[model samples]
Target: MNYDEALSYINDKSKFGSKLGLASIGKLLEKLGNPQDGLKIIHLAGTNGKGSTSAYLSNCIMEAGYSVGSFTSPFLERFNERISLNGRDIPDEDLAKFTVKIRTAANEMIEDGLEHPTTFEIVTALAFLYYNQEDPDYVVLEVGLGGRFDSTNIIRESLCSIITTIDYDHINELGDTLEKIAYQKAGIIKKDGLVISYPQKEEVVKVLKDVSKDMGAELIFSTEDIEVVEKTDYGSKFNYEFNGIQLNNIKTSMIGEYQIYNATLAVTALLVLKEKGLIQIKNEDIYNGIFNTKWKGRLEILKRDPIFLIDGAHNLQGIEKLSGVLKLFKYKKLILGLSILKDKDVDSMLDYLMPLADIVISTEVSIARKLSAEKLADKIKKYDKEIFVEKNIKEAVLKSIELADKDDMIVFGGSLYLIGEVRTIVNLL
Candidate 1:
């Protein structure tokens, strides 16, 4: 099969629709010899910061002169962005070959009366197979959904499990309360293993502490031990202390003050690996890794003249973080372009976003799951009367630009899908 055929085959499996269990994936991987069995994995799960933490950790490990593989969801630009080896996406030819092999294994499962794997499960299986063949030294795996039954949870254990800030998201599947959501995320913790986490709400902290005690895992809260020495719009410099060893002047290219916490989580995880002799990463390598790390679609400044920025703040907690960062910038007027999926808490997200905009242009991504522009406008009108409805994403972006002066700022986001489309258009312009 070719690249287009491979994508079609994988896309066809989406009809299975995000089955939240391990049975199908387990059966499929078992048929392929359980490639995830003996590899060193760093499993990450949370409502926000998983992607950024994965990027920070993987880049650091690769800088230490080790081969690293990362598996993340909802690619920003291309389908191949979901899996990478040492920062490079899997070659299209390799993806095609792996799809052919996985397709046969999936067929066997169906013929044996087992359920068909979902699209995420198949892509995860392919990642495991490819990593097994390539034999990377470390694999940084991000949970596609809640951690407890997520397909990536098929791995029995990980060298380290990292959980970023837990908040209310995916409530329909995970649960409603913060404790319940924390339980699902805490599921990635293994018996007698190590866990690194950001400072969380009081309820979330209690849940994580209880789970760590029950699992015999050692939990290290990164936020309590790290300090942000200095920060700017470009990056941050921080100091982290662990096991009586303190490192200062650590920097990261990823913007936003919240990223300091994410970087610290990555550093804390690396220190755990160091203590266990799992890898030999030095302070210099950590410095370089943090300095060079880049994860797109989070407060990314695409242009300077009109100050175009795109962020993937699709949920309430994420929107709050984005709002905090936006307050640090100066602009003549804030022109907003927004879109979101149907399942998100749109009302809560708009509550955080609508007040900050001088003018809001409601738009929709070209996806079945998107909220219609008119409906989004209805939500925005309740908060801000200065709202415009533009059904097309590109047109909405252009409209924002047309309304903004060189001193003004145009911030377009609410969904990663929207950010990806807007980024593509901005780059072309």
Candidate 2:
């Protein structure tokens, strides 16, 4: 099948919807010769910063002269962005080939009385296959959702397990409270594995400590060592002082103060990787990679003239970061296209962003779970009577640009789905 045909066939399995188990994935992988077993992996899971962490770590490893494979979700542009070798995303031909293989295996499973894999499962299998075929030195794997039962958990162990800040997201599946969510993310920690984490709530920290003790994992906390003194659009200036090492003047290309923690977490994980003899990387690689890395749809300034800021801050923790950055920018005519999954805290998102918006353009994303534009508009009207509803995201983009002035800023967010669609519409991808 061609790339588009393969993608269509694979996505159709989403109709069965999130089954939330590894049994099906395990069986399927076994049939495909267990591509996950032959490689070293740096498994990462969290409520946020997983993508940025993975990207930085992969780049660092690559700079050290190792072939690195990275897997991230909800691609900003083409479906191929979900898998990459070194810095380049998987080529269309490779994705097409892997999809065909996965489809063949899936059909065989169905014929043998097994259930078909879900969209995430198929895509994950393809990542493993692609990485294995490329013979990478390491694979930087980020969990698509909650870590415990996630298909990526199939790896028996990793060189190190990293968890960025945990918060309430996917409440229906991963629980609501911070402590509950922490436990789910902590699932990636294996017996005696090295654990690296960002600053988290006290209760969440306690839960992680308890889990690490139970699993005999060695835990490294960012707050215990790393410190940040400055932040700006250029990069963050920080100091890294470990028991045996002290490094200064570390700067990352990513914007926002929150990335300071994410950068530190990546450094901590790299230190652990070095100790394990996995890859001997230098401090220069860390500095260069972090300073150069950029995760799109997070406080991204798409157009400077009209000032279009697009972010994928869907959950409360993410939105909180967005709110912080928005406060730093000058006031302008804010045109927003916000839509989140059904389980998200829609009310909290509106409560946080409504006050900043001059003209709110609510719209649904490509996904079915997206809250309808009309419904969101109606809800926002209760908070502010002048909410605009545009069902089509592309049309919403045109409207936002048309109504916005040169000095004005158009902020698009509330979901990664919306940010991705906007990227496609604006030809930024």
Candidate 3:
């Protein structure tokens, strides 16, 4: 199949979506010769900051003179973004070629009495296949959802498993409470392997400790001795003082106070790798990688004149972070365009955004599970009855640009799909 056809074929599996099992993925990979076993991976899992943490870790690995493969989820601007090597997205021809091979393997699985692979399972298999073909020194893999049953779990023991901060997302599949979510995220921690985690609530921390003990795995809590000194719009400066471990100046390209935690996780993972004698990473590599890393759509400032900002702050925790950042910019007028999954806390998200928005414009993207534009506008109206609605995403973006003054900001986010659409409209690709 071609690229578009491959996309359609893979996405069609969403009809039998979210099987929540590794069996299908395992079988699918077996048919593809289990390429995941040929590579070393720093497997990352969490509700938020997983992408940023992965990006930070990939940068550090690259700075160590290693060609790294990065596999993330829910592409921001293109499907190719989900897979990358040395910070470059997978080429279109490579993607099309791999898609056809995986499709054939998946069909064989179905003919062998196995269910067709879910969309994530197929993508996961494709990543393993591509990464093995390229033979990168390190692969930074981000879990698509809760770790236990997520297809990405099909990998062998990771070099180190890093769990970032967790919050309420995919509640049905994972669990409701923070402790339950922590359990699911900790599922990626393998037997007798190294696991690194950031500071979390008491309940989550307790769960991690319990699970770590049960699995015979060594768990390193970053908050046990690390701290962030200060933060600005550009980056953060911090000292990560692990017990009898390295104390150094760590910097990250990702903005926001929470990114400090992500940097700590990445550093902690590197230290774990260092202890294992798998790599000899330097403090300069950490500093340079942190500054050089780039993961888009999280508090991304696209243009300055009208201040076009795009963020992937879809959940309550993410929305709260976005709200905190929005408070810093002193823009008088705000134009907003948001498209999100139906399962998201739309009302809670609006509670944070509506207070800041002067003109709230709503629109839907091309996702199958996108919340309706009219429904989103109606919900926003409940928060601020004067909000406007536009069904066309590009039109909504242009409307925001039209209404904003030079100092005003046009903030578009709610889903990565929305950010992807804005990138297309603004020719940011």
Candidate 4:
């Protein structure tokens, strides 16, 4: 099998299961010798920031002279991005081989009258199988959806679990309230294990605190003693002090305020790993790890002349954060491009975004769930702003640039799918 065939096989399967639970995933892993049991895990879950947090943690551990495997969701560029090692995607040959192995095992299970694993389940199972063979020192597992029943949550144990900023998302499957969503994300906390959380709403934190107590797990919020010394368009500089670990002037190349919070959570988790004697390293490793951490699609600058950029703010909470970052920059005008899914809170997202944009270009991503460009433009028309519709993302990219001057900033956002295509068009991917 080749990479294309492997991806086709996975995409051919159902996106989700007929029922929601871990039975099928557990059975599939058992059939494959439960490779998930052979690695140490740092499980992560939240509405946003999972990708950034996972990137920070994995880079740090790898820089500390240890191998790390990472499994994140919703690839921004390629399918291989979902499973990576030491900040690199899994190789094409290995992905094809493992997908074949998983298919054979899944077919056997069907022959035995068991339900076939869903797309996420099969890919997640492939990650475990590959990681077990490579035998990385650690594995960073980012939850694909709500954590409680997410396919990645099938692991039996973890060294630590992180819950990044939680908000209203996937309400139908998780819940509508913050507390209810917090309960779902807190499900990744293991019994008598350690869990780290970014600062959250009062109610959300309460739910997390209670869940940790009930599970006999210890919880530490990463806000213990974080002080941001510098916040600029260039990057961030901060001082972190937690549990006798003093990190001064820790720097990250990532922009925006939220990335600072993610960097803190990642550093806290790494300190725990160090305190437990998991790896040998010094402050230099942590410093280099953070400074060199690479994450795309969130306030990433694609061109300096026009300052063209892209972000993955598909939900209301994410839009709010992106708006916060945009507030800091001084530009002649904001030429914005957006393409979002049909199920999102479109009106609320536009409410936060429309006012900042001088000209809005609505585009449709080449996905089944995308909100059509014409319909999206109609929604923007109510805002009484300059709106343009382009069903082709490549055209939208060219038009956004055409609408921009060297002094004006062009930002493409509203969906990860849009961001991925923009990156590919701009040749950054």
Candidate 5:
């Protein structure tokens, strides 16, 4: 199959839906010779910051002269962004090749009476197969959903399991309560393995501690060991201590107060990796990696003249962080373009962002699950009376630009799908 055909074939598996268990993936991997086995993995699971944390670690490892594979989800521009090696996306030819092999294995699994693999499961299997073939020194694996039964959890152990801030997300599948969500995220902690985490809520902390104790895993907290010395829109300067060694003035290019915690977690995980003798990396490499790491669609500035910014703040926590960051910018007016998925907490997210906008333009992405622009406008009317409905994302962006002045700021967010569409329309990708 060709690249486009391969993508279509894989996307067609969406008819199988998103199953959360590892059975089908495990069976599929077994058919593919269990490619996940013997891999040194840095498995990460959380509601947010997973991709940023994964980017920081993978870049650091790669800078240390080691081959690193990173697997993430919900690509902003292309499907190839989901699977990358040493900062380069999977080549089109390799993607086609892996799809053909995995498609054959999937067919055999169905022939053996196993259920058809879900799209996420097939993609996970493809990543494992690709990384296995490449034989990278380390693979940074981010969970697609709740970690316990996630297909990526098929790996029995990891070099280090990192759990970023856990919050209410995918509640329909993970659970409704914070403790339940924390339990699901904590499932990535392997028996007797080292686990690193960002500071979590009180309930989340209890759940993580309990799970770590039960699993016999050593738990380390980044919040307790890392301190932010200074922060700005450009980045942050921080200090971290590990094993009685104090490292000062650690810097990162990822801007946001919360990103300080994510960067610190990445650094801490890498330090643990170094101590375990799994990899040798100097402090200079760590510093360079942090400074060089970039994760798109999170408070990204697309244009400076009209001050256009786009962020993928689809959840409550994400929206809260975005709102906080917006406070630091000086603008004459806030022109907002927003869209969200049906399953998100739209009311709360709207409540958080609507008050900050002078004029709101509601829009929907091309995805089937996206909330209609009209319905979203209705939801926003409660918070802000000045709401405009544009069903097309591109039109919504154009409308936003028309309403904004040079000193005003135009911010587009609510869903990654929405931001992706606008990014493509604006040629920011």
Candidate 6:
């Protein structure tokens, strides 16, 4: 098996569709000798900020001079990015090697009258196999979906579970209300474990508190004990205090107010580990990690003049955050490019973004779930902004550049898939 073959084997499983249970993943892992067992895992789940939060934790731990392995979803650029060791993607040869091993196990499952593992399950099993072989000091596991039954939830234990800011998303599987979503996010909490989360709505807090109590897990909300000393377009200077760990005059290059919550959540989790004597970490490690950790495609500025920015703000809550940032920039005009999955709340997202743009171009990604460019343009046409349809993503991006003056800003967002494509094109240009 080779790289292309590995991708084909995994992508072929997508036809089986997604499932929200652990039975298949559990059985599949059992055949693979349960590589997730005894691994020090920091499980993360929520609607937004999980990736950014994972970045903080991974970088902080690695900064403390330890090898860290991270498993995240929705690859921004390459399939290899789904799993990484100390910020480097898994080698292509290793991915192909694991795919061969997993394929055998999957076929055996089918022979025993069990369903084939979904694409996420296969990839997750691959991650476990890859990490277990390398034996990193820690594994930062980002849930592929809702936590309770997400493919990554196969582990029976974790060092800690971190829940980033939660909002309405994956409603078809998770649920419609914030409480329902919180319950799913809370599922990553193991019995008698430690859980850290950002401050949330009252109802969400109640749900998390209830779940923690029921499981005998200790839950701590990263208290809103933070003050923004100063903020620039690229980063912020803030003072944070919680659980007697005070970080004053800390700087982070990640933009937006929500990232402060993510960093704080990560810091709170780190402090808890330090108190329990789980790992050796210091204030300097925390400071360096927070200052240097980077997650691409989230508020990334591609160009200086004309301000070409791309963000992975796919859902309503995410778009709301992006809109908040857009209001602060001084520019001649806001040229926006959008492409998102059909399953998202299109109307709500457009409602938040349409008003901010002087011109809107609706384009489509290569995925089957994407909303067509023409249809997306049709929806934008109802709004007051001048809209265009460019089915070709490259053409769509080029048009945005052509329309923008030296002082005008161009923003390409709404989907990670879209952002990845645009990032490649912009880099080459």
Please tell me which predicted candidate would have the highest lDDT against the true structure: 6
Q: Could you give candidate 3's per-residue lDDT for residues 62-150 as a string of tens digits?
A: 99899999999988777889999999988877778988988898889878888888888888887898898999999999998899888
Candidate 2, 380-425: lDDT as tens digits: 8876645677889888898888888888888889888788879878
Q: Give RMSD to native, each candidate.
A: 1.4, 1.9, 2.0, 1.5, 1.6, 1.1
Question: Which segments of model 1 are wrong by more than 4 Å?
Answer: none
State the lDDT of candidate 5 residue by residue for 1-429, as single tens digits: 999998898888354576666778888889999999988899999998998899999888888999999999889999999999988999999999989989999899889987778888888988998998899999999998889988899999999899998999989899999999999999989999989998889999999999999999999887467778877767788888877768889898777888877888888888887888978999989988998998888888888768888998889999999999888788989999989999999988988888889999988888788899989888887774688899978789889888888999999999988887788888742
Model 4 stretches astray by more than 4 angstroms: 13-18
Angstrom error of the Cα, residue 295, model 4: value is: 0.3
User: How well does candidate 1 score on lDDT at residue 255?
Assistant: 76
Worst 10 residues of 4 by lDDT: 12-21
Clash count, predicted structure 3: 0
Q: By lDDT, highest first, what's the ranking?
A: 6, 1, 4, 5, 2, 3
| Reference-based lDDT, residue 58, model 5 | 89
User: On a 0 to 1 TM-score scale, where does candidate 1 land against the true structure?
Assistant: 0.97
Clashing pairs in 4: none
Which residue pairs clash within candidate 1? none
Q: Which stretches of candidate 6 lie over 4 Å from their true place?
A: 13-16
How high is the lDDT of residue 53 in model 4? 90
Put down candidate 6 lDDT per residue, 1-429, tens digits, no spaces: 999999999999353577768999999999999999978999999999999999999999999999999999888878999899999999999999999999999999999999889998999999999999999999999998899999898899999999988899989899999999999999999999998888888998999999999999999888889998876678878999987778998788898877887888899999889989988999999999999988989988889688999999999999999999886578989999999889999999999998889999889998888999988888888897788889999999999999999999999999999998899899899
Q: What TM-score would you give candidate 6 relative to the actual structure? A: 0.98
C-alpha lDDT of all candidate models, in order: 0.89, 0.83, 0.83, 0.89, 0.88, 0.91
Which lDDT tens digits does candidate 1 get at residues 138-255?
9999999999899999999999889999999989888999999999999999999888888899999999999999999999887466778876767778888877879998887777
The lDDT, on a scale of 0 to 1, for candidate 1 is 0.89
Poorest lDDT segment (10 consecutive residues) of candidate 6:
13-22
Clashes of each: 0, 0, 0, 0, 0, 0
lDDT of candidate 2 at residue 268, scale 0 to 100: 81
lDDT of 6 at 360: 92
